[model samples]
Target: MTYGKFAYVYDELMKDVPYDKWVDLVMKNTQKYNIQGKRLLDIACGTGELSIKFAKKGYHVTGVDLSEDMLMVAHSKAADNGMDIQFYQQNMAELEGLGQFDIIGIFCDSLNYLQSEQEVLDTFMHVYEHLDDKGLFIFDVHSIHKILQIFMNQTFTLNDEEISYIWNSYQGEFPNSVEHDLSFFVLDHKSGMYDRYDELHFQRTYPIEIYETWLREAGFEVVEVAADFESVSPQTQSERIIFICRKK
Candidate 1:
């Protein structure tokens, strides 16, 4: 999806997301692993939230996302924050032109949007190419168990004075996948009416073994597998799985 109108309201809807937690994870891992450089590439960095946070922490941050509208919003946000971050409109699976980075991240389960194994592998290969030798690559995904147990066949609703939404998730055609159907209502102040917008988003994830194998095939050394922001191995019921890898 292009994110069109959703780009405008994305931050408002995601206000509760723990962006600082992601930054802390990166910093903690960097210190633990003795990573020295500060150059960072944030893939699928929606609206520059995490990117800005990273920049604030002294990293030279660059962000990439597929949606032009999202990039537009990201650019405006960076400008308003007096940050000099570079925002690129590019597909993560086909990354190019940008120089290498000491750390590359695809946080917030953004990798789930890749529809095929080939796309995931391609993204890994490109990320490997764009990383400095021995550089860290950190990412997270919605665990298969969570997709099946929590999202599939689920309906969620949020009601607020300014904005509200009804979200439904259904099993996708692919294994360990789910399709989200979202309808949003936003109050229009001057018109005294509510504007409705509908969006469909698809996400898929593979088993942990599959991800490890693909990363190895792309010349990366799988370092750690953490669950739900904890520095521990994933459990059967972990909703989010984090992978830490290093380019070899």
Candidate 2:
């Protein structure tokens, strides 16, 4: 979904997210797998946080996202940091004209935004086509257990002078799916009033085995499945599931 005004406040809302840990995860996996290449693609890279981090680490990074507004923010951030990262506006499932990369990532549970299983598989195939042979493909998703046990029927709220939001999560039509309804109140300093807006987002995820099967069908060899930021297999109540695959 297009982020709309949410793009402007995205970074602020995500200020506490562990972006450094994600970068470290990629670095650790690359080293462990003995993969040698500098080219990296960050798909669904919201506002270029991870892309900028990767660029700082000397990776030739390209950031791609479906929202023009998000890409605009990413481009501005990259330029502000004196970085030369290519930011593209494109759907992950229909990736095109982007050259091959040593690593492709869809972090931050971005793949869950896809509405259908076919979309996920199509994205995997396109990612495979854009990856170098034996290149790594890394992504994460909210685990089914987390979706059911935590997100479903949950309400979360945040308050700040500049920004405040009420987030409601409801069980979606499909299994392992949740619809996020968010309402934001941002203070207009000059007017001394708050502007309100609402955003709706839908996300779905499958069992780990289904993801592995789709990766195999797209000609990728599943290398590892880790939970959260750990290098161990996921437990029964793991919140996030990370998959590391290699183009074979």
Q: How displaced is residue 51 in candidate 2, in Å?
A: 0.7
How many pairs of residues collide in model 2? 0
Expressed as tens digits, the lDDT of each residue in 1-248 for candidate 1 is 55778888899899999899899999998998888999999999989999999999999999999999899999999999999999999999999999999999999999999999999999999999999998999999999999999999999998999989999999999999999999999999999899999889999999999999999999999999999999889999999999999988
How many residue pairs clash per model? 0, 0
What TM-score does prediction 1 earn?
A: 0.99
lDDT of 2 by residue, 1-248 (tens): 87989998999999999999889989998998888998999999989999999999999999999999999999999999999999999999999999999999999999999999999999999999999999999999999998999999999999999999999999999989999999999999899999998999999999999999999999999989999899889999999999999999
How does each model score on lDDT? Answer: 0.95, 0.95
